[model samples]
Target: MDGTIINSIASAERIWGDWARRQGLDVEKFMPTMHGARGIDTIRNLNLPGVDPAAESALIEKAEIADVDGVVPISGAIDFLASLPPERWAIVTSSPIALAKARLAAAGIPFPRFIVTAEDVKVGKPNPQCYILGAERLGVSPSECLVFEDVPAGIKAGEAAGADIMVITATHGHPVETPHSTISNYDGLHAHISDDGKLSVVRG
Candidate 1:
């Protein structure tokens, strides 16, 4: 939800950049793979010896919760989300629940009734567990879900879950790796539901 619904790019960069520096890693390589990755998963993937993923993740989450200074809703995100039927959508984020809730509150966005966070699943993005759980919680088949994502990992997870994926391009100057339609933000978009239980989004 960082770049998709919430404008927390700067805050995230600050926090994660510090983490990278502390790990003696190059921020250049660190950031390119930052989006849609859980902190613990990322730490483990970095293959840093002697680093405890869970411990580091807790520390990172603490920093994130305290670093909500610039967090705010993405343009049009509020209206777009408010327009959706509550049961039709849910947040599937790579952040822990505490960090997710903190970011949502900082952005003035209400917490989604159904949320799947990093802590909710054993595996993180690119594995589809989060998206699968999200669809299940929303009482819908994965094929019936349309995922709005900002990172390659999220796109991959959505695809693996059998959902159509759309990339949000606010953080990146161009689209990342999602092989799907991309939008800069929620602008000019509207969602509709048909009598036959089909959901469609139109660009206005």
Candidate 2:
């Protein structure tokens, strides 16, 4: 849900940056690697000596769940989401359930009827498994879904799952280079369902 439905970057960076400093890693270098992936996988990828990825990840999740000070919905995210049929949409996020729900509540966005959180997946973003599962749970084929993402990992995951991608750049600090369609936020966009039940996103 982060970056797509809600902007949690401030809270995310604050907690992760603190963790990186405690780990004696360069915060700038480590910060970019943390987003769009599970905390445990991100920690494991560091391959730090004597660090338990699971433990570190759990701690990070706890901090994330508590730090909702700056978490808020992307502009127009609330109404845009409300405009869609609930069953036709699902949040597939790399965040664990508690953290995910916390952020969504903090952002004032409705909790999705169903969500694929970090706790539900063996592999995280860029694996395509999460998105694939999301589509399956929605009773739709991957090719029939339009996945919204911000980071490279999530974009890659959506593409790998064979779904059309719409990149959300509202919370992106750096320019995201993607050939797929892009939007700054959900503003002015509407979801339309035809009689055939095909969903199309239209811009005002």
Judging by TM-score against the true structure, name the best candidate.
Answer: 2
For each candidate, how many residue pairs have backbone atoms clashing (under 3 Å)? 0, 0
Q: For residues 1-204, could you state the per-residue lDDT of candidate 1 as single tens digits?
A: 888999898888899999999989989788878778998988889788999988998998999999998998888898888778888889999999999999999999998889999889998999998998999999988988889988878888999999988888887866365559888888767778789977787768
Off by over 4 Å in 1: 175-178
For each candidate, the alpha-carbon lDDT, in order, equals 0.88, 0.92
State the weakest 10-residue window (summed lDDT) of model 1: 170-179
Query: lDDT (0-100) at residue 100 of candidate 2?
Result: 89
lDDT tens string, model 2, 1-204?
988989999999999999999999999888889989999999999999999999999999999898999999999888899889999999999999988889989999878887999989999989999999999999989999999999989999999999999999998887878899899988888889899877888878
- By summed lDDT, which 10 consecutive residues of candidate 2 come out lowest? 169-178
Off by over 4 Å in 2: none
Score candidate 2 by lDDT: 0.92
